[model samples]
Target: MPVDAVEVGDLLLVRPGALVPVDAVLVSEHAVLDESSLTGESLPVERVAGERVSSGAVNGASAVTMRAVALASDSEYQQIVRLVEQAAGSKAKVVRLADRYAVPFTVLSLLIAGVAWAVSGDAVRFAEVLVVATPCPLLIAAPVAFLGGMSRAARHGLIVKGGGTLEQLSRVRSAAFDKTGTITTGRPVLDRIVAAPGFDEKSVLQFAASAEVYSSHVLAKSVVAAAKQQGYALLEAREAEEIATNGVAAQFASDATAAVVTVRVGKPSWLREFAPTLAPAPLEPGELAIYVAVDGRFAGAIVMRDQARGEAGQALHDLRLLGIERTLMVTGDVAATAEPIAARLGIDEVHAECRPSDKVRIVSAVQPRPLIMVGDGLNDAPVLAAADIGFAMGARGATAASESADIVNRYDTLASLPLAVRVGKDTVRIALQSIWLGIIISVALMLVAAFGFLPALVGPGSRRSSTSSRSSVLCAPSDRARSGVRIIADRHGRSCGP
Candidate 1:
């Protein structure tokens, strides 16, 4: 079927082993969906009637009938594809100073060899100098060092997209973080269940979880999970309606109550707007709280809070010691919610209530240039592409953010960011050292050849000296030095910054 011709509410038959055509609500009693490609879930999800299934999911053994909720261009999969194209394509190609250094030395070698041949009136003299003066260090040493650095970084569980990302990391002056998932654990757990005068805590929670279970929002999942953990049985909700930018409404089938009752879950304002007869409870000091309404009355509220990552503070401290001039946090969360976390993490600046465009604008205004942005949400994708270097939390991060990033921390830690910079600087330094070593020895041999000293083959210690120089330059710097290079860890336990 043509994607453009697929209209909303059109019925589409999805066969087993085929990709879902569009974002559709399932009409079948049950459909096993493999959403690893879209949502990165490891196991298959069993979705039933009234559940929305996204495009790019592989159908299971049975055929499924679905009603299209969105067109191809407006779908979640298409949105992610656009982000990947923009993020990967927008970055400018980086040029290495080490590669530029080789150009001038090549010219110098040619000039010295040419002069020797012309003055001596022997083409054989030029051949002798050329044989000794071959620039193997420029050709072999730098690329090997860079490759070594990449491998070392991989051992630490980071995936640097290319050599350019390492080069960018080396000179980074500032770093900005996204507060929710990057600095704090993205998971917000339910903390307190505050119920109204007439309602009990358990009853309100059960009703709220039952209604919220139908939503795909992150908060909804948390509510359902918390209810399950507390041993509350979730009832089957009929005719569930998720109001646009508001609350979810459903008629709960409960054995405890004789009649079917209306239940709602969402923000207080949203609940009030959707159900005018329902009264909303006042909000307390938290961001992750959701209100619940039973029938036409206020039932209670569920408060949730996010925890800061264990390694977060230490990573910020390491970044400063790694010679980053400034560190900041940018988030869409309010000042009250964002500032306390920023203070705990030791961030120098904070930009609260930031939109995706606001984040890009903030990055452009950052002083001294060469900024790095670290984030893990789908909303952070655009700014990740805009920054000089972007580090994505790849373990449980959004696909769009990961694809947009220059460096992806594959594990659930930020410790590798500083290490990557150190390795890149060291690689460049070692490459230069090797190149100069080869050039100096080659020039001395060329000078000796100018005199036609002994013969080209009989120069004292020449072969031994060349071999020794190659070994020192080509090998890694540590215990694995024979095979690879590691970050040069000094006595102070601090990375030697660029």
Candidate 2:
């Protein structure tokens, strides 16, 4: 059926290799789903009876029966499509700096020509002065300056899309960020190891890591990495099975100290309920635990947490100095997980548990016309396109984020954000300088032309002089980009351009 015709509560049979057309609650025994396309989660998730799954997840190995939770128009994937389309279709206009000066400059040129015609009583003199008054500097030199700025930013590893983006960056009044993969490392690290009775921490960790080697869950990688750090050799496992979102089970090969045993690791709800003897460990705030069981008996738990980036503090501080009025952390993570991180980073506001549509609304609702949003994930794509200016941290390579953003931080550093702003401001300053420089020279030449000192035809001097002004604008950056470029002025960080 067409997506539009699909109604709520409709039971749909999602076969293997099929894309889920709507948000649904799984009705089958189990549903293995690849949600990476919507959530930026790399591992496949398993949804069992009554568990809700979003649209856009690819159904895995087995067929699944699901009851639709929402119509297609209300699904997550379709919502993003709507946001992108609205942003694309909206006829918002951006006035260019060059264009800003065009009208007045033309009026000034006509006034100068009319005055020359009245003074010299020569029709030919009016033509000469008018020809010399061409806005070539505003037209040509400004864009060249912007291109150099783009090239300069590229040399520094920031992929600015166009001069318009640079203009937007220079004028940013506030900034919003997506938490995961934006301000934090986005990967969990093993911070605590809690072992049960009859098991040492190292032993539990080794077993868990050995089992995780056969899994691709984000937490599994953390457990394995922690084991590696401790210099423990993992035992070889014969067969392993992932228990959906709950945990994993693996059978270890018979070794010197023990016979082949089945080891399971996952959530407390799943493990503790099945194994009543399992020791229940109280979880600390911000700490997620992975429970381990041996032969259906409770073993222990591995506690992990994601850490904020070391450079995040400095980056936010720099944005403040650059006059970003507000900084908000917008995330889908719950307040319990998002607030402390925001406080630690000194962010002024926190918008937690935001869906992609929520993020778009947040960005669109900001008071100031020019706001910058920075993010890196599939979930961030819609808001990125909707924001006044969007920057994608393309450290992990091209993604939906990179496609939607106005600028891509190819260098993968938050610190580079302030640098982009600074470069944009300077580029606009130089571009304006170049444009005005040409206009001033031409106005002076017009005076000479009015007195018949120059011919009726436009002189080569007019072109040469305007062309020479370029070197002052472009070539002054002798190795300046190599050493970090300084903010050209303390006051030029006002708006996009004059």
Candidate 3:
């Protein structure tokens, strides 16, 4: 049946890798779900019968039956989409610096021209003042400087949209960040292996990896990779079977004993069916433990976690130095999982277990104006679009988030963010400098012409020369910006800054 046709109380089967179409209650005895898109949890979660699962979570290694509890339009995924549309529609347009000064500059120029004409009664004097007071530098300087800045940002792996975005970026005082894939690596890795009584860690790992190699679960892949990294020689399974959402059971011939050894690897609940004496492994926040059993006896446990990016701490520190006064982390993960990462990275606040709308609300409430939101998931799209400046970690992020962002960081590193800020600040500084230079020179020439010190014949030529000099001043910043970025990159070793 089509997802749109799914009504409340309708029973539906969710196949492995397929998204749940609506909010539903699980009908199967056990199921595994990947809720990363909705919750930012890196690891898949196990759900038993009678548990409710939200829409958009990917079914993992199992075809489970569920009864829909909400209509497709009212589902969690659809609600997030609606929030994104609403947020994007309501986002305020950034006012350009040039535009803000245009009306005032025009009034000032015309006033000076009219005064010259009225006092001197010389049309020639009036023409000369107007010619010198023309806003060429004001008109051209900001765009050129912003283009130069955008070019520099591009070289450093940031794709800034327009001059206004650069202006907003330069003024960013607060920043909100998504947790998984933004601060953390997003991929689960084996943290440690704990062997039960009568079992060695190596033996437990070897047996788990041998059986897990044939399973399609994400955790299984991590276990296999860890075993390979540790130089474990995996024994080929003589017979293997995978029970969806449960565990993998396999038989492997022992090299020394010359007998078939039975092994099982999966959730503690699944392993407990075979090894009734299995003890639960202690876990810290953000950690996941996979249990292993050998020939109906409890063997050991493999602990896994999504590790924080190596450069994340330094990147946050650089942002603080760049004048981002407040930093907050908003994530769909639980507080226990997010607080530690926030504290370690020096983030001032943590909003955990956020839905997409919740993320938008939290980020929208952040103070000190010109807020920037950085994210890399579908759940982050709405909040990204709502922020004053949205930076999408696009290298491996969702397409929706990238599309919604004002600036897309092409590199898979947070180092580009602070570099982008520096570029914006430099670009805006150069633009304002050029504008002021043009205004001062124009006003001086206009006064000189009005007072008969400069001939009308020479006035236009002097204005042209002044405009040329201002253009040169605008272009010089690009070179300086490039050199400055290169210096920062060298000083930080390219991982912490760009």
What are the clash counts of all predictions, listed in order?
Answer: 0, 0, 0
> What lDDT would candidate 3 get against the real structure?
0.84
lDDT of each: 0.73, 0.77, 0.84
Writing each residue's lDDT as its tens digit, candidate 3 over 6-65 gives 889999989878888899999999887888878899888889999999987889876889
Answer with 2 or 3, whichever has the higher lDDT.
3
Pick out the ten consecutive residues of candidate 3 with the lowest summed lDDT.
Answer: 489-498
Q: What is the lDDT of residue 267 in candidate 1?
A: 62
The clash number for model 3 is 0
RMSD of each candidate relative to the true structure: 11.9, 10.4, 10.7
In candidate 3, position 20 carries an lDDT of: 88
Highest lDDT, which number? 3
lDDT of 1 by residue, 268-299 (tens): 77777554655444544334568888777888
Please report how far candidate 1 places residue 229 from its true position, in Å: 9.5
The runs of at least 3 residues in candidate 1 whose Cα sits more than 4 Å from the true structure, single-residue gaps closed, are 1-5, 8-71, 74-90, 115-123, 190-286, 290-302, 332-336, 352-367, 458-498
